[model samples]
Target: MAYYLGIDGGGTKTYALLTDEYGNVLGKGKSGNGNHQINVDIAANSIREATLSALSEAGLQLEDIRHAYLGLAGADREVDYMILHPIIRNIGFTNYTINCDTMIGLRAGTNHPYGISIICGTGTNSAGRNTQGEDYQCGGFSYMYGDFGGGGSLNIEVFRSVIRAWDGREQPTLLTDLLLQLLGYDAVEVMFNDFQDYGKQVPVDAVRLLFEAAAKEDVVAIEILNHQGVELGKSAVAVVNRLGMANDAFDVVLVGSLLTRGDRGWIRGPIEQALLTVAPHASVVTLTTEPVVGALWSAMEEDGLTISEEVHVRMRSFSDFELIK
Candidate 1:
């Protein structure tokens, strides 16, 4: 029996799955973030570790695999591809197909056939695959250029607001107190040195704390979510319009852990409403999928196998190592 492999490269965690050619489950593994924007060395190591771990769980040597397909988040552009392909090749797989994480999630969530997948986990993105199997994607740029509803953007918004409050230029909110408490300081300035030291620690996630404060209905916090929701809705609209997924099918899917959080309703719900207004033909719902399963579906597609209900259910039923929180 031949074996196939699939990987979902994420910002915080890399998920991998090993399955028989028939899509019967075998083994699964995971590693750290493979997002290029984070740390390239960490990204490569995550893929390598996750691949090797999957192989081991399957009780086979790495060389015994027939094909491996990796769906990584940041490999959309040329520079990202150029850097990733070589590292991936060096890992010594026989056949490897790579694309942005958004594309892979679409394949995973759609049973590896055709449909749209919206990743709304720690970050947010949407991808559509036509009946012909051609893929259309939107969003995944980091916080600087884009990244509306993502963790990074949320963090940036709250942190900047905190600074504004500290400078006496903006109204105070529960965020300032929450953040200061988190840092063991009465005032943000007391820890300015530790805050600016990005080399020692990443401060990007600070905004998530702000989101929590907003969830408490703090005035400043509520405004932050309102603003972020509008922005996120705008980004989602661009994707639905550009890809024409609204008319292709009446359905659009949402993926990612962001939806699992209660506060995300403020952001994602508005995006759905906005999408309907813009793309009245598009039907939106939370995606029910595990991308590891998507990898399996992708592997089957590569081998000219038709994905069916039986296969889809089995793949979706994959049980393995726990997702470490």
Candidate 2:
């Protein structure tokens, strides 16, 4: 009769899942902007709103929950813990564990409790959990922290390639034309002027041009993707080496849009090749289940419940449940 609650809070949205001990999803809820680093009050409110909506949909109260697991963005440092602990306490959950959102993404991509998760979305981040239950993370801070190879970073590379081609520093590339078309510029000089003199930023969506150009066999675009893929793979390798998981048979979960969407083969191929150079037994998996379901699985495991095949099946099947919103 016991119920569990799981929450995934990110910069874009907050998602909550309510489920029974048997892993039947009872309710779902969602809200906006749950990264506490952006605004603590707003993040807390988003978490509460989502949790309350899930509870209401399930006709349950907070006190009825056995355990809750929250995977939240910006929960990385101890200082972050200092900020988030009281927020969770004040929300009235008596039994809960909070972890970085990357952990949920890792869990979502694989059923194993320990593995590496690489996120290549707007930004790049890498994290891993070893069989010893130890966790290590790298490259989520910003570009200054050596965290590169995502949409934001790819956008920069695309602009640089176009500029290089324009100045004859690099061979002319299809990306130049694509960039000109995307930004509505007739000349690379005008685009350069707008970017430098007018402080115009490159649109993140422009990163797709890399895939588009690569698909057309543009050497520069393919090289860019290959280089970025190697960088992303190196991040994963760093985690694998740190965790001593090089020989471990485990999953290397790929999370985020860059690795999951578009013509991913250009990047994914290089990444897999790079990973195999070290962790030969590692398998790369794209996350198919909602990350909040991973939070539920974590909650169940924390409560000493065995996650059976039936549980996995039920959770995956119900992952697309309507959000309370």
Candidate 3:
């Protein structure tokens, strides 16, 4: 019997799925960060370990898989691809494709060829396809490329606001106290010193604390979510307009932990309102299927297999791996 593999190689964690040719999921696996820019050797091992775990669960071996698809964060750059492609190939899949994680989220969001996908995770990105089969992407270059308003970005904003408030450069916010408490520090100065020493290693869960503050109607934290909502919405609209889908009815699928957070619509509300300003007719939805399922769908589509509605339903019903948290 032949099997297919689909992997979502993300910055926070990696998710892998093993499925039959008809799209029934057999097993799932997960591991740590798989973004090559974070650490190539560690990322490769994460992917390999996750894939192996899935195969073991499915009671299959690498040689039993006919095809595989990997959607990897940071795989867009040639250097990233060069580093990842071989690692995936070495896993022994006979046929495979590697694509940016944004693309998989896009595919997972809509069945139509033309639509937009916005991902707001530890990082953020947007992807869309037009009726002419041309694809467009926005804001996947990381914050260094001026991208803003992902969870990681929000985390940065929280610290910045706290620092400003501490120095009296900005209005005092509940975030000042909330962040210091969350980090288990008595003073903002110590958190800043430790953060500078650790760099990107600063705990991103500060954004979650911000979300909690927003839920309690804290003004400053609410404003932070509101600001990120507008930024993310603008990214979606930018891709829609770039693909000339502004006037047409299209799906704008929201993906990732931040955008899909089970909040009282703090972030979702503002993004919808902002999108309405630009593309009033555009429909918005959340990605219900795991991205790796989308990778499997793509692999099946490439092989000229028809995806039945039952398969879609079955794939969507699969649970996310625990390690993804």
Q: Best candidate, lDDT-wise?
A: 2
All candidates: TM-score: 0.80, 0.96, 0.84
Off by over 4 Å in 2: 319-324
Please report the candidate that would top TM-score against the real structure.
Answer: 2
Per residue, candidate 2 scores C-alpha lDDT tens digits across 125-179 of: 8899999989999889988889777898799899999999999899999999999
What is the lDDT, from 0 to 100, of the residue 156 in candidate 3?
77
Ordering by lDDT: 2, 3, 1
**Candidate 1 lDDT score at position 188:** 77
Error of 3 at 164 (Å): 3.1
Clashing pairs in 3: none
Error of 2 at 112 (Å): 1.3
TM-score, model 3 to reference: 0.84
lDDT of 2: 0.89
lDDT of 1 by residue, 1-325 (tens): 8888888888778988888877766777888898877898999899999988888878987677777778887877789889988889887766878877776666655543666666655666766666666666667665666676566456666766788888898898888887777667777786666678643332555656755886787888878767666766776677666665566554555666555455556666676778777777666666566766776677767876677887777766664546532
For every model shown, the clashing-pair count is 7, 0, 0
Residue-level error in angstroms, candidate 2, position 43: 0.6
Q: After superposition, how far is residue 139 of candidate 2 from its true place, in Å?
A: 1.7
Model 1 score (lDDT): 0.72
Cα displacement (angstroms), candidate 1, residue 237, comes to: 2.1
